[model samples]
Target: MRSLVFLVLLGAAFALDDEKIVGGYECKPYSQPWQVSLNSGYHFCGGSLVNENWVVSAAHCYMSRIEVRLGEHNIVITEGSEQFIYSDKVIRHPNYNSWTLDSDIMLIKLSKPATLNQYVQPVSLPTGCATAGTNCSVTGWGNTMSSTADSNKLQCLEIPILSNSNCNNSYPGMITNTMFCAGYLEGGKDSCQKGESLSMDRRNKKEEEGKKEEEEEGEKEEEGKKEEEEEGGKKEEEEEGEKEEEGKKEEEEEGKKEEEEEEEEDKEWKYLMKFEQQS
Candidate 1:
């Protein structure tokens, strides 16, 4: 699963001074329809729409009250596609550990179902595990760099999934199964310190699914070959056993014939001895 770490903003509603996206560019308007801004009075975290009534976000972003803004491209301007809905309930993971950051996920139920449109839709959940080197992207309104101001426009950064071992090398004893890393090891591109929702590109995800299907097909083929080989081996053993039985039968027949001949000779010799004695 792609994990999100959001830096909660406590200041103004449009505070650009907080953590932001690094090495990212402005996303095409409404390209990320699932992306949503989690706000109380001010924007605090980014989230993704999972369904018409639910949004997924970081657990640490939980607040007593939250407003979810969907179809938002520019945070400052009012886009016709934008839909603002108050959260009816917020459910954070029960096992969330603040220190370890494990199970750092939350779900927000919208007070009303979001109207689905071209500019507002839910993202499909991933079905398979994200492998290393899988291409993905993150989107948020965070700053492009530490030295720069936050962007009002939604920014997206392309990144590759990192192996757990490699991520652990960077933060020893900190990586968890609930977390997976994506970004450059050299530190060129990354999501903003403020939360950016990570997502695997649909194309890449399809490719991964394709690869898995091919692997399963290969395994089935291998199993079939093994079955064929085992059957051939059994047939050969049965043939060998039949041949051995036939050879034993032939030897027994020859022994019986020899015994019959010996008995006939004995009978002839005894008759000859009786004729000589009579002479």
Candidate 2:
């Protein structure tokens, strides 16, 4: 069987951020404007507002009907910066394979433009590549520890970007070009939860997709050229066949004319022989 990757929206929603917490610190409400929570009934996953109408997140974090909470802090208490709205559309990466978790990214289109304020805003994309050992921040509403309950308020933690070689040693044959490792090698404060929307360099992903498209286009052009050449060859063969048929018809007509002349000459000689006999 050719394995096909299918997207399934599990009715259950537990924040992976819920799963990956250990010693996470709490933050004040409305501090991170671009930070958003995807809430179906409760906060399921974290997302970022890349545009007024778009939210970028992990494909693994999909919900059937998403209620977007922007400028949200604590899920339990209501705040002024909090804007709750329904999503207009949900689009997963075209090449996303749920089984492989390959290209695990998704985009949500908002029905209405998010009202950008101090509490609700967009995050800027990285201009350059992240160097190994650089400290970066990760935020989510996951549990503080494996034994504890999932947090109602948002939390943030600082983790270092691990070098590919070092990360490979830790995970061993699991890292991919679409994925990288970022967390403490010691493993005390890692975002251990099925934390949605780990900071991935989406620009690199887009560039890779573009390169694949260009290669496919080149192959299509080559195939088209081959087809045209085959058609031209068939046309030439047809013309040669017609020429040969015409030559055979002309030879047949010449042969008939020669036989008629010979028959007429024989008749004339016979008539002359009869006249001589009569004289």
Candidate 3:
């Protein structure tokens, strides 16, 4: 799996300028109803509408003047669904640390409420923290590759939530309770650079319960079949064990490869930082 670092925004903001989607694809238009583009003269960050009059994003994306464009899919062209509204105020987290990117969240109040429509809607706030290994998705208009320009259309990527221990091991002394990491540890996929909101694909509570019940029933049936097969599978089991040993060796090689890729990715980030500073 590819690993990428992400900052979790809880009732706050995030900031990203000139960031793009890496290893993502174009999403269906208007599928992400809560997605919005934060702009001044140009797109700087991505945000999610919490309500008609407020948006959540990265604190570092704050500017003197920001325009929140709702229902925007293809930002390079005007779709009739777009609603451009200016920011009334921006509130960044007081505890935000730019150096370490701790508590990197912000909120923006819209000058006017966005009109509710099929293309413009608010996202439900998560009631609790997502558990490790949960699947989530991120959408944005950031560049698909490091060397490419920003994508005109919205892009989406699915990533898994990493456990806090694994995250700390990857970032080493940088993760906090307020922050969580999601991405592939093997490299090649990430949320551009910053200012992208991570959203969970939540199911209705009743639907989830029903699905769980079905899964339990299926597992019980499978258990009976497995018991029947085990009595006749001794030879196959031995063969499987031999295959597993080979798999372990392959896994060790893959781990070493991932470590090398992580180093390369770090070098790429450093180069990008130097380029940005010179520009």
Reference-based lDDT, residue 77, model 2? 86
Worst 10 residues of 3 by lDDT: 1-10
Q: Is candidate 1 or candidate 2 better by TM-score?
A: 1
Error of 1 at 162 (Å): 0.5
Cα lDDT tens digits, model 1, 74-176, are: 9988878899999999998999876676777788999999999988888778766768887777888887656655578998877778887887887787777
Q: Across residues 139-240, which tens digit of lDDT does each residue of candidate 2 receive?
A: 777777666677888887666677889867876765556666677777677565442333433445567788989999988888888888887888888888
List all candidate RMSDs to the true structure: 6.1, 13.4, 33.0
Give the range of the ten consecutive residues with the poorest summed lDDT in model 1.
5-14
- Give candidate 1's error at residue 199 in angstroms: 1.0
* Residue 9 in model 2: lDDT: 11
Write down the TM-score for model 2. 0.63
TM-score per model over all chains = 0.68, 0.63, 0.70
The most accurate candidate by TM-score is 3
lDDT of 1: 0.76
Q: Which stretches of candidate 1 lie over 4 Å from their true place?
A: 1-18, 204-279
For model 2, the superposed segments whose C-alpha errors exceed 4 Å read 1-18, 194-279
